[model samples]
Target: MTVIDSATENVAHTESEGGIISWVRPKRVDVDLVIPVYNEEEELDDSVRLLASYLLGRTNEFGAPVADGTRAAFTWNIVIADNASTDFTWAIAAKLCEDFPGFIRAIHLDEKGRGRALKTAWGQSQARVVAYMDVDLSTSLANLDDLILPLLGNQADLAIGSRLLPQSRIRRSIKREFISRSYNLLLRTYCQARFHDAQCGFKALRLETARKLLPLIQDDAWFFDTELLLLAQYQGLRLREIPVRWVEDAGSTVDIFDTAVKDLQGMARTRRTLNSLSSEGTGEKENARAKTGANATAKAGAGASANPAPALLPDFRGALIPRKLSYTV
Candidate 1:
């Protein structure tokens, strides 16, 4: 064991199937970002490298957020969740764990479902917050700070990226665009959901909240994101939607129409499930929140510049003092 003078500075390592594991061996992290994949060999390496390096650039060698922890916000790592990829995705992910050591890890599942992969990743994670995004990195990374800061400041219980928002910038084929808008429209129309977009892969939530909700989630596929968010809304939890800059992946493998049909079925099932929960009084849902997408934007943390949010970054791996956060609501 590699030992340090104190527990706060201590670190450990163990050789495992995935590689030298260390980060969580001591305790939990501030945030965990999982990239769930299925047969993504071609995009696996580059995407992981880009994402991990981008994350690393935010922190210094002392495991503290850069420049007095303002920009760093949280100590974080990435997990590559492989959903029975029939290719070299797992192998590549394992190598990344080795390359990044404590900052990146991998998990393999025999089943193939984005929801299953996420449920497993988020369920097992010890981070204060757990989040996921597509391997393609469809959403711009700038929006990530906006996504995470709110959850940390208690400004939101969950945060999601939305391409349908008026402020969003997007580029894609007409068919995909139409399908995307139509799906969210149904979510607003029939489901009575207030959030603008439901299916964006980029999402984050406090692990505390995730623990309560993951077990209740039923769908284990593409519809999982939508279902999970709907349940959060049913519980009347705070949700933040950030307008994102997204560019379509031309060689995407998803079968849009087939997924859409399945999603319609899932939506129907979810509508029923939500109604049941509300009737049973299990959700504590707000009539205003469920009926319309008009939840007020949370106020920003007072007396601080907006750039480094909340004014104070918490002590690393230590206690976090909650503060009310304000930003684009």
Candidate 2:
């Protein structure tokens, strides 16, 4: 097999893998695709190896017009973020990291939320773009580049695979399809969200945007994706919705009703939070205007500067602090 090296040259895997391994062990990366897993020991090895192989091939297809009109190729890495799995998932992940060297790495978290795992792994990464997908590989691997292109081209701040899009091809049960549509309908009605799908497991974001917004996301569970999307919309960030090919995996562990109840509650809470912020912002603006009016009155004829600068909005960056995440490849 041939793999693209750091220099963008195609070389046999055995020849280039070790050299790139040495170079990337301590350097920044172009893309980091995280797979957040919890007690998925049975699927760990196959899924990780498949993803790694796909990404290795993906690098050879890059080098088009990316950010700033520069011809850049993607040097991608896979991160397996294990969320406190009681099973042998962590052991398998560590072995995969060791086997792939610089091409793959693993992080073990003490908590059991997929969101928590992604939060830590992405925060610790120095990659330009960060992404995550389900371990079941329900979404087609062919759409990976499509999900990433908008961010890479600087055309959008976030990219999401939308199984709800009209062009999306899905092989799911009628019950699941109904539930998905209903959930997205609620998002549109309650949050006034514009994106087609928020619950899709396939998603990516620019690292800068992730850093700025991940702090404000309050949910540390299944609602994490929804919360992140809602916050991004509230912040006026651009989103690219790509229609994806999806296949529902059999023997899935998710409880639809339980997750739906939690999601609805999360939606309500997010709406309240956004409304509160808006009210606070309005109050701050009014106070600033009042002070400005007072100053203008006092200096009416003293040749004061005609225009005063507007007050800056509150900074929410401190909401979540990034920890020193440990990883071993």
Candidate 2: tens digits of C-alpha lDDT, residues 1-329? 12323343323243333111211234677788899888999888988877776665532212222233312247878888878889998779767866777787776777778788888878878988999999988998778878887788888888889998779999999999999999998777666667778899999999999999899988888999998987787676778888889999886888899999999999878877876766676678567666766446656523334643222233333221111111110
TM-score, model 1 to reference: 0.76
lDDT of 2: 0.74
TM-score for each candidate, following the candidate numbering = 0.76, 0.78
Which ten contiguous residues of candidate 1 have the minimum total lDDT? 318-327
lDDT of all predictions = 0.75, 0.74
Q: Where in model 2 is the C-alpha error above 4 Å?
A: 1-24, 58-73, 294-329
Question: How does model 2 score by TM-score?
Answer: 0.78
lDDT score, candidate 1 = 0.75
lDDT of 1 by residue, 1-329 (tens): 12111244334444444322223324477889999999999999988877766666654322334553333557887888889889998788777766776677677887899999999889888888999999998887667888898888888888999998899999999998899989988776666666778888899999889999999989999999998877776666778889999989898999998999999999878876755544444233344335545544444223123433222123233322222322234
